[model samples]
Target: MKKFYIKTFGCQMNVNDSEKMAGILRSLGYEKTDLPEEADLIIVNTCSVRAKPDNKAYSFIGNLKKIKKEKPETIIAVGGCVPQKEKESILRFKHVDLVFGTFNFMKIGELIKRAKKERVVEILNSKIPEEDKVPLIDSYLENPYVAYVTVQRGCNRFCSYCIVPFTRGRERSVKPELVLKEVKRLAERGVKEVHLLGQNVDFYNYEGIDLADLLYMVSEVEGIERIRFTTSHPCGFNRKIVEAMKNIEKVCPYVHLPPQSGSTKILERMNRGYTREEYTEKVMMLKEEIPKVALSGDFIVGFPGETTKDFEETLSLVETCVFDQGFVFEYSPRPFTKASNFKDDVPKEEKNRRLQELQNLLRVQAEEKNKKRLGCIEEVLVEGKSPKGKELSGRTKDNKLVVFDGSEELVGKFVEIEITETSPFFLKGKLLQKVKV
Candidate 1:
């Protein structure tokens, strides 16, 4: 009858980790609660990718101190990237009963037991063996029809501005058999879509089996109607992966390649291993191979020593690529990253200005591209109801969000929709027909 609450921050990887932890807690007879103060245990799953999220995690953990004092028996745990990087320093909050790291979620039961007795901190500094990594748990999926299965962990590419390699350790791929096994199990449980996750998902390789092979293998699983993978590094993404996406019927034609910056000089300074020309070449390859492919990219506006010319080059890249979606961020140095050592010469106001300009350009491009989809019929997998309205919502194969009128019976099924209205962010559609699988 005990209740537990988990507050998660940052990306899909962190969300998956939190789900695994929730599953572990459920197995220990703990029910999840939305209210932190009402729970017997409260967990703050943190992220340190950006200064905003990193500071937010601290603020959240600080506020939990009051709940800990109000309920003396409440157990407080802190886990994820922040704890992985900060280690025992997270315990400075005093009320934190247990602190675990990115690689230590499998030991949650043991840690919680020890925390009940005394304070405990467990941050594994080395690679975790395959048997010890977090397993796919069906119980904690927020969406029954969609799931995120992490096929790889950590990052070998230590980009100058990233904290992932420091917090998550080196790249380690889950065995292909293990990944396929998890995929089959998810399909059997009625999951229609699976998103393979990693810091750099295209870098996934177990033995000689690569991400492209994994895609083909996953497609063979019956009932798995769609497969998507994310956060690919352009340097590691290859033609074979693009071919897999083209040949496999189930593999969604969407790629989230983080270009980071468009200027080759800025890219070199950031330790991103590809030139702007090379990155665009890859983008062109994806577009040529999968004509319907929806391209998503990440851009950092103001890195150390970035100039007006460098910023202009980035704007040109965005303009040329015309990404269907673009996530623009102002560069903020992180602890242990090489970029932190360089002088942060860009003024805050200038960084903000560049960010706004880049964002405006991206928005214009997105709206222009989305407007082209009007009246087109899109195959959408109904994930659930829209958060903003009464309409049912789902995503197309290329990851475009479509909302339309539908019954609850349509939640787990695929349907064809005629794009009626479009915005930079999502598409409003009319349900045309139910797709017979």
Candidate 2:
């Protein structure tokens, strides 16, 4: 009858980790609660990928101090990237009873019990142990029809501006059999969509099976209607993967490749192995191989030594790629990143200006591309009701959001929709027919 509450920060990986922790708690007879104040145990899953998220995590934990004070017996735990990197530093918040690392969530049940008697701080070393490689089959799914399966962990490519390699450690892929087993189980449980996740997903290679082979294997799952992977490094992404996407019927035609910067000079400084030209080649390859591919990318507006010319090349790349979606961020130095040592010469004002300009360009491109989809029939996987509640919302195979009027029965089914209206962000559609999966 004990209740637990979790506040998750950062990307899909963090969300999946939180779900795994929740599953472990459930197995221990703990029910999840929405409000932290009402829970007997409170967990703050943190992220330190960027300064904004890092600061937000600390701020959230600070707020939880009051609940800990009001309920003296309440246990407060902090885990994820922040704890992985900061280690005991996170325990500076006296209210925090436990501090665990990125790979330590699998042991949450024991950690929670230990924290009850005394403060516990366990940060696993960089290398992921063999036992930790096993996929969490009991992970609680937020959406019954969709789930995130992490096939790989950590990053080997230590980009100058990135802190993932330090926080997540070296790249370690889950056994292909384990991944397939998890996917099959999820499919059996009514999951129609599985997003294969990793810090560098395209780098996934277990034994002899690569991401391409895994995609073909996942497609064989009877009830899995869609397979998508994310956060691919351009250097690791190859034609074989593109071919798998093209040949596999179940694989969605959406790839989130972060090209960091478009200028060769800035790219070199960032330690991103691929050049602007090489990055463009890969983008072109994806478009040529799969004409319907919807490309989303990440861009850092200003780095330590970025010049005006460097920023222009990035703008040029955005124009050339015409990304379906773009996540543009103003660069902030993070601890332990190589770029943090370099002089952050780009003024904050300049970083802001460049970010806005790049974002505007991406927005314009997205609007133009979305407008082209008007009147076209798209296959959409009905997720749930839209924010307005009157219409149902879902996503097309290419990952474009589509909203239309539909019954609740259509929540987990695939439907054909005729795009009636479009915007830079989403598409309004008319339900044409239910897809017989």
Candidate 3:
């Protein structure tokens, strides 16, 4: 039997995909290992969202090159967004035995069988592959309490600054019955939390079923205590999703709405298909519908034609929205994005300065908002031990991380935690007792 090590990078989708790949490899007698040195095959599941992740992929590949030299029989394969974007470039490294795209993993068992016979480079992903209905949260989950199910695949948005439409292709949703079947299996396995994943989750629609219907269906599954969905687009956020969050008791009161730029003009340039006021209107509606709802968003500073005034608009919007937590990005041109054709006029130094300023403001807001949770009691699902040890970590219903003293027996159970200390990023809490949901 051969051993394999997979270095997964980027979002939960990539994580799910990597886990699925491992499951596929199991039938071929390939066992997963922790160390690259101990494995006969090393797979680098990549990300290409920003410049940092893009560079990190090559840097890690370079390090792996040395390992390949020492042991020539070791096979190094690269998959995911980076390879989907730069298919031919990955083969430049002589040590790399295979290069595949995001949707090509279903054929990996066949690919690996062929690779053992000869060197192969497969980067052919021109169409959206048929999606597997089974949930990926099982077998490969780091935490038994939680799981991620991919309900949809690809994107059709074609936002000017985004490469998702090119790399992932058009959006298509999984059947609601299939989604419910997977959730039912997870419930049977004692999984308490289920997170439905997609590029733009709100746009999910299939056979008279949408995201809201899927959420309601999953909530009906026995032993399923919570449901969450992520990476929703501001343009597609409609009343159905808001109603789901309000009526469905198991649905978490959290939404990650990515408003690329706060300035309407910059947003228009990005082809986001929504205005600043429109985005805030949706956020406001969600809050009004569910008062305790935690709002998080995304921002991109120093876009192609952004001016100082435009950046100030973003800052002003941030102050107005007061996001519970948000992410700020410095624009980087992607190969198939419309921004690539325009001159990247924003000076790198200026972009960095703006990014720092935006992040600083968001940090202050996050700390101030977190302070409100200091005396509040939150229900958190115990996931696993903390990285520093002697402490256990879990997440609140709204997706806030809370750490406390706990035993391994409490790993998959829910406990009421009194917020003792509040940091900008997470909360320190004390568990009262485990509760039955």
Candidate 4:
């Protein structure tokens, strides 16, 4: 079998794209290979979200240049947000055989065929792919219990500081029936958890049906014991979704709401639509509805117009909300984004200070949150062995990572674990009992 190696970067959305590409390659008799040197085809599924990841992609491609020189027959391809954004510049490296955009992954065979004759760069302008056009990958990294299904493609809200609107195009959703069919098929294959992915998942609407409706349908599928979606905007996170989390037993009580900044002025500068007060109100409402729900959020420090007071507001929000998980990032202006042209006035030193300060506060809050679960029991879906050690890793219903001793047979099963120890990132657990398979 012809072996293919792929390195994926960025979020779950990128992972889904890489899997889809793998499915297409598998159709052409290419088996997945861990080693890039042993592969006939090499692909880098990239992300252009921040400066660091963008630089990482560039550095990786630079290293791959040597690999191509030694093995001239190995075809190299780069696809996803980075290629979609960089376009012609990505082909500047002579080693890059083919480049495709986020929406054109299914055409891998044709792109490779064209690349053999000359450099081929195909970037689609549209957002969504035709239904059934993108192949479904049933397997991932030997984890058979969890899956990521793209309910929608692209974003409608073009936050001034973001490049997703340009690279991913507009919001286009998959049909609810199609999504349900995939979940059912996954259920039959023993999948227990399915996370519906999107640029802004709360915006998923096919006709009148929305994400809440989709979640209800997916939870009804035979083998799906846990349900989830991610990266929500406060605009569409209404009472329906809150109700879904409350009413549906299978739906996970975890939400990722990215309140970029807590200052209305900075939020306005970012063009994030909802006000700070509005976002806070929404969070409060959700908490009132689902008392035990755990929140994970995103924060950006040192926006173009952020003042000391604005930074304080962000810190205050973090303190007030006490997110179980906080993803903090220093703002890096991306190309073609409005903030890039708006003069990045936040000093490098100041930005670094703000990031560290925010992280320090969040760390204490996260530790406090984890410590609360010390004697409590939580149901966890056993994922697999941790890369760091021989301990088996699993996640709670609210998305808390727990490590404990277990066999490979427990990888895909749901287990109830008592929190024996707690840390900021994960918990040390003791084996309690196995739940439903």
Off by over 4 Å in 1: 131-139
* TM-score for predicted model 3 compared with the true structure: 0.96
The pairs that clash in candidate 3 are none
lDDT of 3 by residue, 287-386 (tens): 8898888889888988999999999999988887778898999999988788889889999999999999999998898899899998899898988898
Q: Identify the leading candidate in terms of lDDT.
A: 2
- Order of candidates by lDDT, top first? 2, 1, 4, 3
Off by over 4 Å in 4: 126-142
Q: State each candidate's clash count.
A: 0, 0, 0, 0
Give Cα distance to truth, residue 104, candidate 3, Å: 0.9
lDDT of 3: 0.86
* TM-score, cand. 2 vs. native: 0.97
RMSD of each: 1.5, 1.4, 1.7, 1.5
TM-score of the candidate numbered 4?
0.97
Please give the lDDT score at residue 252 for candidate 4.
Answer: 91
Candidate 2's C-alpha runs over 4 A off are: 131-135, 388-390
lDDT per residue for candidate 2 within 296-333, as digits (tens), equals: 99999889889999999999998898799999999999
lDDT of candidate 4 at residue 273, scale 0 to 100:
93
Error of 1 at 370 (Å): 1.0
